[model samples]
Target chain A: MSRTQRSLQLAAYADGEVAQAQRAAIEQELAKSPVALREVEDIRAQRAALHRVFIEASPTAELSERIQARIREDRQRASGRTWRIGLASAFAAAAVIMMSVRLIGPELWHQELVSPPPLVARALAVDAVLGAHRVCSTLSDGTAHDEFRVGQKSIVEANRILKALRAMPKEGAALPDLSESKYALSSACACALVSNCEVVHATYNSADGVTLSVWMSDRPLALSGASKLRRVSGEGGRVYQVAEVAGGYSIVQWDERLASVVLCGEMPADQLLKIADRIQPFGSAARPTVGPRVAIVEMALLRRS
Target chain B: MSGKSFEEIALPHLDVLYRYARRLTPDAHAAEDLVQDTYLKAYKAFGKFELREFGVRPWLLKILHNTFLNGEAKKKHAAHSTEPQVLDTARAAAEIGSVEGDLRIDLDGLDDEVKRALEQLSPDFRSILLLWASMELSYQEIAEILSVPIGTVMSRLHRARQQMMTLLADYKFRGRGEPPNGREAT
Candidate 1:
């Protein structure tokens, strides 16, 4: 056998990886050649050295706790989704009953069924926003969704929506320039979450592929009965409501006069708030930076709004 | 076996996963993130994992390998860089043959030197060496984790050892008995 071939075989033998039949032949050869035997010894020594060096290298003490915490968070989100699904099924049955009554009763009853209770309407709006974000962000066939237009397309669409909102008689929130924040506008879609109300959904993607979606509406969403939402004061004494969504994602919503905005992403509430602070409305004055304590309080105060 | 939770079966391999992740990534933070991503993905797919003779370690490693590769592919696409080069086995074997000597490698007091040698290798070589030397996974298991043929694993392992030996030989001859960077040997 060639010298290199023999060397490799010695390595395998030293590793105890050689087949049974080849092992005896390698042993017989090793007995004849001192050089080959020494090579095997060297391989064994290298492996031992590797073990010694790497055994001293370990992840941080908190790594285990961090992973465990994440798993717990995921499980909680899953259970919450299950509860929401059950509630949604109940709502679906109620809707079917209302539809039957509307069809059999007067025209006024048809109008009442058409315009749902404000709380239920807001819940439906929230569901629609979440659905749009999922459909736009969900990757298909190992590629990003085609509808998630980026670059000039996203920027132009965002500007058009901003202009349309600005032309309206009431003041509206401007789409924040996320360039300084290291996130680019990936897509913007004008979706009608409520009848006659157009909500602009703008998605931003960071360099590391973290997606943040911002939904802007000209009218205030009736968020009073949304479950698990916490209200917190941001920089300009603005009351921002935050909540955890189905996938451990955070949603931060605040009302601007004639404009209501909701920011949603997989980021923690504090990070999302920081992104929110950068999103200045058209005529609002600059506000002082909030502390991490506010974020802690906001997280602690999670309740049905 | 039937009633074991995902954590019961998979959490025991966290250290192994983290060590391998450290070898794959450049920093401690990135390694932690990689391990976290691996665990999350594994937990999601745990329902589909069937217990094999080699147990959950290999399955977790396969997920880690795929996760790392996907991240690497994204990074490459963003940077518009060429694919990483695969080791040329014949040329590596020739080079290994040229380094002819009975120079003793002092395994003692060479931790830093060994780490530096490992760091200097290409990712492919480092991966193969760590799987074989550090994790001590068998050739078939290594092949399974890497999704490569067993013959490819053997050849690549030979190349990895050859490269490691070459780097260690340089350190040995240059540093003599002292450790690299004048640091006291552990």
Candidate 2:
């Protein structure tokens, strides 16, 4: 390597960032020239010292989660529609239940019998829109996913999309322990619970120093005090939730706002309160005592069988 | 794209994102959380993600970088105590199991003078060095994360090394500030 290249390489060499061939060439220079060798070695020392000095610093996990949540929330707002929300909700339901139930998800049955879940519905709409974009991006490149209709340039290439999705590898995460309930969607409230809970699961682990967890959803519908749900509003907006029921557990309810989201779990009221505090612009609190959790709990319980 | 479900797409990048965050933040708690944020952002934008030839790793990294920089830059304007001083803890014998007061680098036989020289560079410089060292990326990819130009990336790396060499040659080791055992020339 020339002297200039060797000098350019010093930082990368200290970092061990260079490729094998490049590294070998640099090493060859070090052997041939004492100055080159001394210079490279000096950079390496600084690199090591810096690592030892700053080994413990990193970004807070909360910021990362918030960013992701912000993106998710933005996308949701962009495709604003009840049907879309419903499908997206259904998907949120399925993903949560898939964690709490059998690997062979029963949401498929729900997909057929019940209207497709909310998250799924939303994605389908987006799939249609993005599918159009995909086709456009494709057609712009001169290759059509399918033979174009003689006059219809606006139509999506549905078959290709379906094929790609089917061929895609699964989206993975740290799944919750689901040995309990079949799916969180057996009841309408369960759907709400899953969405809120999964957001917690997705979000809690990543905040700085503040430990966040999405409590396990136990099956067999064994927990007591589930029937006493109370609806409350927080900084986000009006929250429909259950409170102070069986198991000393309160139902935290609220929307996934741009800056606020309500939570419901078996965790301490203090911790949940702290979560609420961290998320701002919460809506006013409401105590609309929804009908006994009996129907909802019964629905969830029966589905466990 | 459309056909692929959530698990198929987002999970694979978690570990790498975590490792990157860990290095950047240097604090275990902060790194864990930063990694999670990277995932959530990835998940939400999964629909918008297209299969560009450059790949998702870069995209995710770009997001992570933006998120981190946003928070970090905001904090920079916030007031803080005086900068961290050079803490002289007895090179914790258990850490590298040294003899008397010597520093032993188990990863390699490289000596202590080299180790301190590294610590002198700023975090940003160190990050650039690591990105270059990791070899998992090309110059364009590193530029994307660091938000620098291909040419600037080239120049910054050059300057970073020059700084390191100058810093190392001037450093004083222990009390004497001379090479250990007075062996300046190997």
Candidate 3:
């Protein structure tokens, strides 16, 4: 080998990364040439120095937790989209039944067989007509908390949204453990009245500008009109959902474990479902309550079931 | 496939990912962001990951490296207009004129000097050196992670070491306010 080629081999040999034969060749060259020997020594010293100087600092405990949390949020967000689409299709399929029921009679009442649980039915009926844009605009108009931002600001706004939804302690600065639902926390919110009941309007936008707006309320929603609904099994239980397209947007409305949720976006029904599926109740305080209205809806449904 | 499967296959490499990310990024915050983004992307694409065909470590590193490079390219593109290229000509002239100095590089303060020098190298060179030296990843594995040939890894590693030595030794020469020439006459 030429001197330059031999020298490169010496570097590999110093790192102990060379083959057995190449190692022997390098050792022989080192013995014959003092300059080559010094080069090898220098390389070894450099490696040693790097090993000593470079300290592999252990990441903080928060980092691993943060990473794991972010991953969970991501998976939920993705599957949630799929679930939403599935729910939407199910809702669309139920529409044919809606037509059949109309022909059959008022015999098959929405509450009797087909409607989702009560709160989900009520909020969705109102959400279909009353868009979340007005809620966001209300916040932007300075009637509520301002700064309707996304991404980094979403972290703070997540808590703000939970508070608006009454899902957390409304006063304290201590943030809820949101690693689970943190992915959908990417937007702003305001508590706005829909059909005479207060609801939290939270709009979460992905980094790529896909927006999923959620309308949530603690009050059990009563089905107002001949609402179309479908029963679909979700992560926790049998979630009732409504999927429809109106005003150039696709919307999915469902009952989460904690609140009645209505999700709207300019994407496919499935994409809207993905965001809806990820919208977990933030704290222990936000569990769904079986109120008198829900009891009445359940009684009517049970009579038919 | 399942959350348990994802945790089992991928979460074990979190430390490795974080260490390498620290080397790639400027600070802890950026490193955390890079690793978080990498894991999220990996989890999303886990359906396509064939664990039996390729190991998780190399796959995770590839994601981390790609995410970092894309962020870097974006920043470069953003700053490209504002950055002055006139300094390039001046720097090149100064590099060519550098002569070997007699001052021996002191090992006393080398820990910090070596670190500064490592950071001074381009991301490509620094990455190869870190993968080989710190992470102890094999050339074959690095080739897969970097999507480069084994021969290319070897050459880049050698050049990286040479450049590092030059930078480390040159620190003393530079302290004297002269052009650094620890470049050996090969």
DockQ of each: 0.16, 0.08, 0.15
Candidate 2: misplaced stretches above 4 Å?
A1-6, A9-34, A37-305, B80-120, B164-176, B179-186
Report the C-alpha lDDT of model 3 over A83-160, residue by residue, as the tens digit. 665565565457546755464654433333334333333333433223334333222112122223333454555554
Give per-residue CA lDDT, model 3, range B1-186, as digits (tens): 335677788888887788888877888889988888887767766665666445788888877876675565335433322221223324533542353232235455578787788788777777777777766677788787776788878877766766676676677666767655554422
Off by over 4 Å in 3: A1-3, A85-305, B1-4, B52-54, B80-108, B176-186
Which clashing pairs does model 1 show? none
| Global CA lDDT computed for model 2 | 0.41
Candidate 3 pairs with clashing backbones: A80-A274, A81-A274, A84-A273, A85-A270, A119-A221
From the highest DockQ down, the ranking of the candidates is: 1, 3, 2
For candidate 2, lDDT tens digit of each residue in A1-305?
66456566765665566889988977787789886666666555545544443343434446555555665675586577445545655665576577455435545323222221222211011111111221122121111111111122111222122112221111221122211221121000111122222221111222222222222221111122333444445432334343443333333433221111233434455445545434322112222212223324434555676
- Of candidate 1 chain A, the 10-residue stretch with the lowest lDDT total is A139-148
Give the residue spans of candidate 1 off by over 4 A: A79-305, B83-104, B176-186
lDDT of 1 by residue, A179-207 (tens): 77888886665544455555766678888
Name the best candidate (by TM-score).
1
